[model samples]
Target: MTPNPPAVPRARLPLRAADLRGLSRLGVDAVVGVTDVVEAMHHTIASVPGIVGPAPAGRPSGITGFVYRTVRATTRTVGRGLDALWAAVPFDTTASTPEREAFVAALNGVWGDHLADTGNPLAITVSLRVGGRPYREALATPTGRLLVLVHGLAMNDLQWTRRGHDHGQALARDLGFSPVYLHYNSGRHVSQNGRAFAELLDELVAGWPVPVEELVILGHSLGGLVARSACHLGAARPWMKALSRLVFLGTPHHGAPLERGGRLVDAALGLSPYAAPLARLGKARSAGITDLRFGNLQDADWQHRDRHSQTRDDRAPTPLPAGVATYLVAATKAGRPIGLHGATAGDGLVPLASALGEHRSPALALKVPASHRLVVASANHWDLLDRPEVYRKLRSWLR
Candidate 1:
């Protein structure tokens, strides 16, 4: 008989006596608040261009597009490794010690420091505004339902309001739902931060200054998975009972072909150490490269772990406590070409067929559209996160 896999430690679940010393000695158990992740992203983006060397020291600005993006991606891989180390003790010393507190405080400061540099969340109310208007006004009026908007990998909340795409705030203003933003490492495993997300949700909901009638989540691409993980893990806790709705836009319900993409990239880059590092960055898994890199979360055999373990398909439709409604939005536009080379499904990162939650049995499915991945014009993985269309549909559904 296949022996049950030795139990892995989850932050919220009870820890074994043997592991308690390890866990507590561990400061915070890699509790990746979206705030921490957003801060990390700020540091990364702010430093990337310089680290990549915009012109390679006096060279003409003719840095080829391919070379620039490649170097930029390489810098991202390095930054991600640093983020991973910051997630946990990294060293063998147990977290129970006071040293753990210092480490925890340092990691916590990562976001805090970045927020300070950027002024702050409140500063966003002013510094983050565009066209002399604030985003919170859309739905943050005295009597508005709180709606949280989450972004996907490689982007931030400001991206949501850039130029022609002010979806989150617009929804808040139009539907009378207050918009809250979620920031996290989308490239990381969906489950690594699941428990933390649950706790964050509890903190967000339980700590609401004013009573919020509803708590709705709109997650794009990887954000959807984060939202899903939060729902499942938080259900095991006390506060999520108030969460009312969830909306997924182009999220990879099943693991995206990204793993498949990773394999191809790995093979294409074999032998060169650069290829090895790229494989680590591009490898697709639930916990993400953050685990493999910083050695924070437990690692599964990237090449062969069970797909089910990587994703949360085991969830029962009725599993979510009654009261919350679930909705899905998918993109069919492929990054590949059309006619002779046009792709059939997905918006690059996620397959169109897979993005729709066909497998979620008896969950609160939507009546808004028919089954297949409808072509979302000019859509791609990143676009799903910031797409105006997505926010429009998401706001309507979340409302």
Candidate 2:
């Protein structure tokens, strides 16, 4: 066999792998955290002398005024939207009358939180009217296996639009396999969104256009964990019986060691002047972790679902269910340390071993050659879901 070549070099984030865990568990879902966004924005402005200092001639007086006006306009718009939403809440907790009762009844009728688009990074699924499209909202139907690809944090479904020449739609065209892209809030707790995700799957599977012969779930980073959890939760349903294969791409199966970095940031931020909006991030069993762990929802073991969630603290990854045939595609290149936190090994987001779990350990994990590469020409965590190597493997696996 050809010897493995030297690893590619890239700029490294100071954050350790162990410390950079699923931030959604800390509650930073979809993409980057708010504070980090603010910080990045702040740094961007600070670095630009023109942005931080006085405006150019014929422009607003100073940078502060510019910032204020810009911020004010944006905030005003958002504030009005929030006000309308709150006004629509239909409830008066202080009142004790028929109107309150009616409001409660109406509120109870409203089961789920509004799926508002707040520039949420988790909104990866492309919204298309279902009538004439190949796919919508991860909907799958049987003519053959329907593969739904879910991406991780800071990513969108467009990642899987295609690999090289082969894309999600192409897979459906050539291989007789159906492909759907999944997108959600990566910043939310894994289990919390996973639970809702399960519900969504239940709906999709139940309404599948044809008898779903099989389901192939492919997820990267946090999406992998969520996918597994979803499968477990759907086990009892008749629709779940159609699930045949599972694939995890750079998922932090046992939590990323780097998660600790967010925890530390939360700690430091708490002591600093920027404590108000950040207090939620630093707490133990943070919002991010909670989202993955059921979001304060009860974990009844009636079906033995979510059992893997039990040993998350263990160093090694756990095995998947007995019947399911699972596959893992790992990143061996230089980037973030997977599980060791600050130390190096595997990719930054997922440890090679962890990404594979027990069934698809790194030993058999395959690599994608550069000639056929696209966005993931041997890139990092973000590429696994969108690149050709991954999509190629998934298409074949589904077949």
lDDT of each: 0.48, 0.48
Stretches off by above 4 angstroms in model 1 are 1-144, 265-322, 334-343, 359-375, 385-392
For model 2, how does the per-residue alpha-carbon lDDT over 44-147 read when each residue is reduced to its tens digit? Answer: 34444432233122223367446645765665565455445544554433422333222222221121111112432112222211212335443545465666
Candidate 2 local lDDT, residue 319: 33
- Worst 10 contiguous positions by lDDT, candidate 2: 107-116
Models 1 onward score TM values of 0.51, 0.53
Best by TM-score: 2
State the lDDT of candidate 1 residue by residue for 187-290, as single tens digits.
44555445556776677666566786877777776666667666766676755766777777776665466555544565554343222323332332333432
What lDDT is obtained when candidate 1 is compared to the true structure? 0.48
**Every model's Cα RMSD, please?**
19.4, 16.8
Error of 1 at 67 (Å): 32
